[model samples]
Target: MSDEHEHQHEMPATHEHQMGSSLSMAVAATLHCLTGCAIGEIAGLMIATAAGLGNGWSVVISIGLSFLFGYSLSTLPLVKVGVAPLAALSVVLAADTLSIAAMEVTDNLVMVLVPGAMNAGLVNVVFWVGMMISLTAAFLVAVPVNRWLLSRGKGHALTHEFHGMAAAESGWRRWLPSLPTGALVSVLIAFMLGGLVVSIADEAGWQHSSSAAATTRPAQDNPAALALR
Candidate 1:
């Protein structure tokens, strides 16, 4: 009975280690989502600047593409590991898109509202710094919110189901998936896209335009003329 009690005691320590592993996997998954989102968003901004696109259009394109690419980053890995294409695609899209969209909206709002950051041309150090700072701050806020959602098993639940499936499938699987690697690759892709946009915008002579102010008509001092004349 004592030996059985010792064995039971050891089980919890083992479970604790497994729980730690799960936590790491969860974190890696979220970070991957963040990386892909950051890249896609920055690239969108750059493309808008280079193409002389307005803020509205740039933001829309960036959001759409960011979500698409972010989902793809996650889905590709799972699909490669023999997960069903339809299921993998479904989960990644659902899990990462909401989080990415939330981050994008908040972070971009900061960039647009910050003084000297708006349409402020593509090359200003101050503008870039402001955008980066805003994004970082947004990320800090976003992580906990996302983590809370994940704890409920709702945020990353989709992708979580795929972790063990990689080993469950048969030989000659065409894909290899890694949460950490997928995240890194996605970020790199976004950075490259961003750099390209900046270069093109620089070459094409895109510059910030101060919005024109609306003019108001002066109130009629002619009211006196109407009464008298």
Candidate 2:
């Protein structure tokens, strides 16, 4: 056989190695998408629940923010490396939108199907439990999608092919904080929990103030009661 033909043929070992690396890349891509989704979904849900928005509005807000954050995570690094803002955004849009949409849909559907999950409060375990379940489902669903895209050289492959070199050359990565996959997920969870605690405290304090005001108002309204006390 000619040299080109020989080169095109890969041994089983090399094929297996490529497969392993591709699988790892797909998982990492899914996790990156997951982190962005987690931040947006939690923040949107919390804001929606706190404001008493209906389920429809909550989903809308969540999806909007998910796209915003997802595209942001991909786009920002490129922009920092001197990629034009719009070009970076366009690449990220093509690279991330489908994955993000799939994730958001899967997670939101889980939330809706879980009884009372949409209505659950920030402090409620039910809300958090549903969130965990939804996010896990999103991750599971997105992995295969990302894998398929990567195989076609359509997903993060696009990023690796374009602008990946510029980012390395610019040395912008050193200036940015890098979180491992597990640590990134942990940080997102901590953020959600911290918000939950702060919201619960604020609500409790407001309720207490309202109750005290109600008690004092009645005493002030009735001089006899005040005098008797």
Instruction: State the RMSD for candidate 1.
Output: 11.6
User: Which ten-residue region of model 2 has the weakest summed lDDT?
Assistant: 165-174
Give the best candidate by TM-score.
2
Which ranges of candidate 2 are over 4 A from the true structure? Answer: 1-10, 162-183, 192-229
Off by over 4 Å in 1: 1-27, 167-229
Q: How close to the true structure is residue 133 of candidate 1, measured as C-alpha lDDT?
A: 70
Query: For each candidate, how many residue pairs have backbone atoms clashing (under 3 Å)?
Result: 0, 0
lDDT of 1: 0.68
Error of 1 at 33 (Å): 1.3
Backbone steric clashes in candidate 2, count: 0
* Candidate lDDT values, in order: 0.68, 0.83
lDDT of 2 by residue, 129-221 (tens): 788899999999999999899999998888885544444444644465434558877888897677567766777888999999998898899
Put down candidate 1 lDDT per residue, 96-164, tens digits, no spaces: 766776677777788777887657665655556666676676666566656666767766776766777
